[model samples]
Target: MSSVRKIVSTLVFAALTITSFQPALALSRVKDLVEVEGIRENMLVGYGLVTGLNGTGDSLKNAPFTQQTIQTMLERMGVNTRGQTMQTKNTAAVMVTAKLPAFASTGNNIDVSVSAMGDAKSLQGGTLLVTTLFGADGQIYALAQGPVAIGGFSAQGDAGSVTRGVPTAGRIPNGAIVEREIGFNLAAERSLKLSLRNPDLTTAARIASAVNTYVGSPVAVASDPATVRLAIPADYKGGVVGMLTDIEQVKVATDQSAKVVVNEATGVIVMGSDVRISTVAIAQGNLTIKVTETPEVSQPGPLSNGTTQTMPRTKIDIDEGKGKRMIVMKEGVSLQNLVDGLNALGVGPRDIISILQAIKAAGALQAEIQVIG
Candidate 1:
């Protein structure tokens, strides 16, 4: 440990030793700790149209699909437009999608996303037409229709154009109403089953023991590392609501597996608290390549009346830093210890990113690297 943190830790330990009570480690809530098995979100998707666009719609000449779809919709409405080519400039084809949460009932409103499916330049100030969203079973479960809230804008001029965010996609808050519900009898089961989000043999055993101790009976059983089944008492047999309320408050420490997350896109790294590393040395270096362009005017002749042409000039350069700085890390060290050791060399976040990556490559880093774009 660094001298500063070591001293602070020493002081804290001495104070805790004298105090009658000490702070305990914080634990996650039971609801946050486990997930109900067999329950999941529902995906609903559909093809629809966006109207009210100011000439930013699909060109029917190039997007025959859009024209065909419109014709089909009209025909369904008892209108015959067959063989009649349409040159519409006020409509855009779109895909509407939304997620229905588990246990969602009729009339539940869900936010929907509408994205342009054709070559519609923009969906700005457009309203989504009545769209039926269906599940994988081809059953329509939701109806979505509302004014789209495009998150961007676009403007054009003879010389250039300006655009911001994304104009071809938009969102409608609470735009879909659920017309069906997925059946899942959670309280009707003979016994309660708790599924761990990250199942561990030790954690499953602990949960089973805790539940059994609270009920004054050996009713909870660790069926597997990922599950713990509990038998409901006769008094609370069908009244699972009360039993869950009581069990959810019981504190049970959990153990997590060792993992390392690295974001390659943003050069961010996250290591599990339990991650360990053996002694190893690592070196890191930074290399940069730069390119520049210079436009030159070429005159046909010194003062002769001739057209002057433009020639492009380019230059390239490279800047290579010194040899990698070797860092030695021992096993079983905490995150704070690792941070301190790296910071001691005045390494910033950007530099530490490269150093950690190199360390992992040399088999010195025990954590995983995840790249996030």
Candidate 2:
């Protein structure tokens, strides 16, 4: 009985020791925070016209295209203006644009944006005409037409013009109807590929292992750190969507590269999550200079027929501030500790950037440094 108890105790101690020194468990599930690939929104564009504006419409003299369109529209309403020239006020020409949401259905209404393309002063009080929206293939994907809802107002005078926001552009709520649907066939793929936002070998291998263990089969394999190839199985052959739905729900640990980001113009600094440094010492120095200019007049002694002359005088000065708090950063330190040590010296953000560069130059920092405006 005593020997059996001792054996059990030794096994328990060994298990605890191994667990303590093991690597950090990254997200063990499958999917990332964002969608991988072939899953996004589509853009649709169209041309249209706006009417019902107060005299602030397109000028027929400048935009003949507007006049021609109006004429054609009027003729369609049984008005004969083939050779007759009829001008109408309170109308504007505009271009319409909208984003087709992912997996849009036919006959579904969506919002559209309308912008005046002519010399119209405002589209605040206007209604858009029906226009067909086309995709990249020039095929009609949707139809847009609705009342304009300009959020700004404009007033003009001989002295100046004052306007806020964009009076020439406005959005119409549910003014466009989807006439066509883009095909997104996930089931058609006998095998699916999972692409990672970042490429990391450790993460890819972990994902392949987790999927195989969870599903009890080797359905997922890592092609590279950034791409994972998944085979469609028999149970999930006709259920690709279902399988993906389950796969995306699984979480995987994310790994980032070792990098240091600095913004000089805005004085911003960001340390990468995985940055580490070796045993290196860092020292920062600053230099400042000042120059002053003054003028003086030199007169001839006792006015001995000599003209007074003006002389330019200058003074130069340099003041070096004494170093404060010579801080020491140890080797193999984490980013959090490193930044905390620097911040303890009350280093300004811009100065921090300079110090970091100096550290990189001295081979102390083992991470990439990026500067942005």
Candidate 3:
């Protein structure tokens, strides 16, 4: 019995030691917290024409640009329609857009979004023609041509019309093929910068510390609250790519300033876990006043020559909210306690918004209040 007791005690001690070294549950990987500087997507845009629109295309008289585009396209195809008054309802002018992903190679396919630029009723069952997508530098990078897939439909008669979803927008999967690649050499770079999505001084320092601990050297430095500069170590064999791959997986506990965001239009409230309040007294109530009008008809006697008149009777009542009382909140109250206390007062989101704003003005709320539409 004595030998078994000793083994159990040793196992319990080891388990406790391991648990103490484990990362916190709220910790996030470095990759999720920061984005590499140079690796990003580029936007590509182009003007194109969609055919087979089933009479939902732009009107040539209303949209003169569409007519001019059609004339230009016909002339390229060895057809002359400049002098002719052509009325075609089977085509639409559309804007094609796509995002060229990082490290994209030639012949790689990407999805494209198509939006009608003219007064076209719908884009369903339409096939986009060969459109050349261009980058910001005026260089052609991709070619898009595919059947447009719209999510909604539009149907109309003489009296009414029924439309669901957006009929003027659609998407085509694997519609664009890359013809040129953006010049970027990640492996050849000696250093890189990591930009935090949410800038925080403590979080940036923690990230730098975590990276240095992983590399067993002080190669990473927190240049600012929003950026971390990393110098590749000489002994790391994986180059820049390998260094990023290893360091991005390092977990770090993120910290932020306490803030409360409220959307007035939506009546939605969001409070951070770090939000707190000093000891404060709060009382919320509404004073209601109601007025009702009742009309009565007054008729003269049968013998007398008099006309009937309508008389108005009004009743007014006022309520001062006598049932509500003031409540005291202790200092260092957490987010959960604040919410529970507010709910106990029977106030809704709109009322809560007003109460929070009032608390902020009273210098009792320790967090910053941000009001959005």
Candidate 4:
């Protein structure tokens, strides 16, 4: 019995020790906080033609380019339509766009977006022709050809028409086949850089520290707030790829600057965790003046020859909010305290935005105020 009790107590003590050493929930993996440089997507764009439209295609007389493209395509198919008036409403000129993902191999299929470049009412049930997608370097990298899948439709009668969603734009999943590959040798590289999505000096340093601790050496260094440089050690195996795979999993606690973002158009306010404020007094009020007009009719008395007339009367009322009082905030208030203080004043988001701006102007706000939209 004594031995069994001692074992149980030992297990409980071990469990508590493990729980105490567990990482905090606020820590984030290095991969989510930073992006590996040179591993990115490339934009590819092309011009194509959509066929099989149901009388909702581009008008040939209005879009001359559409007629010209059609003529050129038919000439390649051993048909001459240049001298003839070919009025067709089953084709539309469209622009095709796709993104070539990082390390995309040849023959890999990618999705493509098709948008009507001309005045096409709808692209429903249209099939895209063979379009050569070009990269920014003007080199063809992919070929796109598939049936366009649109989310909306258009139907019109003699008087009215109703459309749902965007009928002129559609997508074709796995519509593009990559014909070329962007050459990148991740394993052969001697060094690599990590770019922080949100640049901060403290976050960068913390990331560097985490990487060094994981590798048991100072292999990573924070060069700047936005970039961290990592040098491959000589004894490190599996090359740069292996080193990155191991370091990216290391967790680090990130820090950010105190900021207050307010969107005037949406009346949204976002305050950071570290936001602080100095002692400031704030008072919010509004003044409104209202004018009302009333018309009075004047009539002749006892059937005299006087004409009836209208006399204008105006009433003006002025209201100055005199019930509002000034509220004093102490120095070094946290974000929650600040929100509570603002809410105590019974003001809406718009009014709070104005008050924050006024506080910032008076040099009382310690955090950076960003007004957007």
Question: How much is the lDDT of residue 51 in candidate 2?
Answer: 91
For candidate 1, write residues 31-114 as lDDT tens digits: 666665656898999999888989999999877888888888899999999987677778999999999998899999999999
Q: What tens digits encode model 4's per-residue C-alpha lDDT throughout 145-210?
A: 999999988888999999999999999999999999999988877788999999999999999998
- The predicted structure with the larger TM-score, 2 or 3, is 3
Superpose all Cα atoms of candidate 4 onto the true structure and report the RMSD in Å to 1 decimal: 5.3
Q: Candidate 3: list runs displaced more than 4 Å.
A: 1-25, 289-319
Task: Compose the digit string of candidate 2's lDDT tens values, residues 1-373.
Answer: 9999999999999999999999885564466533556666788888778999988889888888888888888888998777776566589989999888888899898999999988998998899998988888889999998789989989999999998988988999999999899898766777777777667887787777767776789898988888788887867643878778777767767666689998898998999867877776655555668899998999998949999999999999876655655777888799888888777776788888888888888888888998878
Residue-by-residue lDDT tens digits, candidate 3, 1-373: 9999999999999999999998665899999999999999999999999999899999888888899999999999999997899788888999999999999999999999999999999999999999999999999999999999999889999999999999899999999999999999988887889999999999999999999999999999999999999998767978898999998999999999999999999999999999999999999887889999998999999999999999999999998777777788999999999998988888899999999999999999999999899
TM-scores for candidates 1 onward, in order: 0.77, 0.74, 0.88, 0.86
Clashing pairs in 1: 262-369, 262-370, 262-371, 263-370, 263-371, 263-372, 264-371, 264-372
Clashing pairs in 4: none
What local lDDT score does residue 189 receive in model 1, on the 0 to 100 scale? 62
Number of the top lDDT candidate? 3
Name the top TM-score candidate: 3
lDDT of 2 at 367: 89
Instruction: Provide backbone clash counts, one per model.
Output: 8, 4, 0, 0
Pairs that clash in candidate 3: none
